[model samples]
Each structure stands twice: as C-alpha cells, then as structure tokens.
Target: MSDLIHKDPTCFPVLEAAGLPSAFLDAIMDGVLCSAEAIMCIPQCLDALCLNNNGLQAVRDRNALRCFVKILTSRTYLRALTGETPGSLSTGLDELMRHASSLRGPGVDMVIEILNAILKIGSGVDASFSSSEPASCSTPLWKLMLTGAIR
Candidate 1:
C-alpha cells in the first residue's frame, strides 16, 4: 500500500474506495518520518490527495494538520532538513499554500496558530536556507515558513 501510494499518488481515490482512507493517511504521515525516501515522496502524495475534494476532506477529517505538526516537530524531520536539500520540503510547502484556503476550519486553528508563531519568530530573522546547521528548535519551522512565503 505504501509502495502503491509512492508509485502513483493519483491512485488515492481507488484506495479510498477500498475503504482505506485512514490507513492511506497513516501510511503517508508515518512514512514521512521513516526515511529520506519517504520524506521525498510526501509532497507528491499530498499534491495528489489534497487537490481533490474527497481526498482533501479525508485528510481534513483525519486531522492531518495535527499529524503534520507532529512531523514538523519531530527530530527526524529537522535532521533531514539540516542535512539534505530541501527538495520535497519546498514542494510540500507549495502544496500546503495551494490548499491553504480549503484546509481551514476549527480543527485547523492549531496549525494556523503554529504558523502565526513561526511568522512572529521568523519576522525577526533573515534565515539562510543554505545553512546546514540547525540553528535552534524553531529553525526548521522558520525555514518552512520562509520557503512557503517565498513561493
């Protein structure tokens, strides 16, 4: 199932039809923290899933933002950012921006609040995306904000 999603994210509807939306989302969220390969595959999965009405709702229903917060806050994700190119990270931010309006609701307020905090902290610093050192706990968070805003 993870392979299928990685191979063809457009197969989302089929997976949903098979009554596996929860499982599919779980795979995506969990995969993101597993390794660099899974991290790179995530933007494509999000692009395919969040672009459609049903798929977007499924993600929202799953409180996917909370999952995202968990991912963003994880040491693994920060390590990936500090050590590698921000390929999927940038693309994933783009997808999030594209779906920003659609992804809003009471359930998403927490995400919004987090973003606001990032913005406040980010507004104070000129973050260098080229740097490999993790500046602080919020370094990745601010980088993500700047990346998303730059698009």
Candidate 2:
C-alpha cells in the first residue's frame, strides 16, 4: 500500500481507476496552510458551514479559504463514486488508491509541511481542525480526519 503512495511501480496495484487525485487534495491543504492564518477558527468555520449552511467565503474574510474549507467540510465533495468520508479507513483507503492513480499539480508541497508545523494536530478539541501536511500526500488529511474517531 505504501508502494502506491510512493508510486513504487514494482508493486503497483492492478486495479482500475483510483479515487480523487492526490494533487487536488494537496492543493486544498496547501492553500489552507499557506494563507498563514490561525486555525483556531477552522472548527468554527466548519461548524458554521455544516450547521447553518453559511457560505465558506467571508467566514474569515478570505475568498481563498472557501475551497479548502469546502473540500474539508465534505469528504464526498470531489469524490462521488468512492463515497470518501473524512474519517474512516474504508473510505480513506479508497481515497488513497484514487489519489495514487491520479496525477498531481505542481507547487505548495513544502508549504503544507510548514503549515502542519504551525497547527497543533490531535488537539482533541475538534475534528475539523487538522495538522499541516506535505502538499504532495493525501494521508495527512486522512489521518487527521480519522483522528476524530480515535479521540
């Protein structure tokens, strides 16, 4: 399975089409990270969107934050066939497989890693809040999303 993420062609899966591309998720995570704001409000943003259907935009006076927030708000937003939920192994693994099969866009990988350093992961106060992660990988979000269950 790690081979899939690392793209180890020697042991690549024989299955057909994977789920959402890693780069897309990475892009969203990267945007959230690079905007350089405190994540103390992410849980609030998430809750407001989920509870009130409030617009993701203007939640924190940033238009860029919407995409990142929307992607995080719903696991199945970009993924329909796979039904990828935020914090579950069955769904997240499927998301990983899908990510492995797809191609990635460039830039922002390092920024997300730095962003992860800024955020306090496993804070245990909220599920929507997440750790910063490398923009090239999908596992960080998946792991962060699943941490809610673990807590």
Candidate 3:
C-alpha cells in the first residue's frame, strides 16, 4: 500500500503546486500556524490547492481568514491544543517562528515573527480580542527590542 501510494505521484499534487511563490506561501502558512484547526487542515488543503495551481493570494482572501478564524476560535481547536489531537496551534507557531529565524532578504519574516509573538503573548489575556486588536500598538515593543529603547 505504501509503495502504491508512493508510485502515483499525483496522489499529492498540492505539495508540487505549493511551489508557486515563497512569500505568499509564507504568509498563508503563518496564518494557519496562528490557529489550531487551520493547522490540522494544512496538509490536505495544501495538497488540493497545489494541484489546482492556487497560489498564496487565494489563501489570503478575507473569506478564507474568516473561515479559518471561525474554526480557530471554536472549542475543537482549543481542545486539540489541550492534547486531544496531535496537531497543536503552538506547534504550528513554533514551526513558523523557526522559519522566520532562517529567512533571509527582506523583513517580511521578521515582521510576521514579531506580530505572531505579540499575538501569542496577548492570547493568554484574551483569546477573543487578541485577533481583533490593532497591531500598531505593538510596534513600540518591537522598537524597544530592536533599538534598546528601555536599556
């Protein structure tokens, strides 16, 4: 069965299609990593989207985020994070953070990393509003970290 699955390369065309744009993929991956439910669907959706040539922009649509947030905010995602399943939102965030560290060139990865970090910290306070709050207020912290504003 394993060999049969491996022999038919089309069995996973999404991974191949995901080769589109690295920047877009990075953004979509970052969003999925931000939520637990979305993380569980990552492999399947990634495969399907890849087969259809759907790029990162397709995943960036407002409706997509709405749907992702709905699932993310649901009890299912929270339960999964609590150990009801193998995929946890924290794991996805960790993977994204690691990717952010290895990224080169422009500051997209840095911005995303900082944003995710702030969001994670805020999540502990209010999981609901954490997603809705403006990120601008968080900029000062980044400035402090980068410029040593406090020390």
Expressed as tens digits, the lDDT of each residue in 36-84 for candidate 2 is 1222223322222222112222222222233434343332332321222
**Which regions of candidate 1 are displaced past 4 Å?**
1-12, 28-31, 84-87, 104-151
lDDT order, best first, reads 1, 3, 2
Candidate 3 C-alpha lDDT tens digits along 71-131: 3433334333434334444344344334433222222543455466445544454344234
lDDT of 3 at 106: 23
In order of appearance, the predictions have TM-scores of: 0.53, 0.20, 0.29
Clashing pairs in 3: 14-47
lDDT of 1 by residue, 102-124 (tens): 66463357567667645644564
RMSD of 1: 8.0
Which ten contiguous residues of candidate 1 have the minimum total lDDT? 125-134
In terms of lDDT, the poorest run of 10 residues in model 2 is: 101-110
Q: What is the lDDT of residue 133 in candidate 3?
A: 29
Clashing pairs in 2: 18-98, 19-98, 116-132
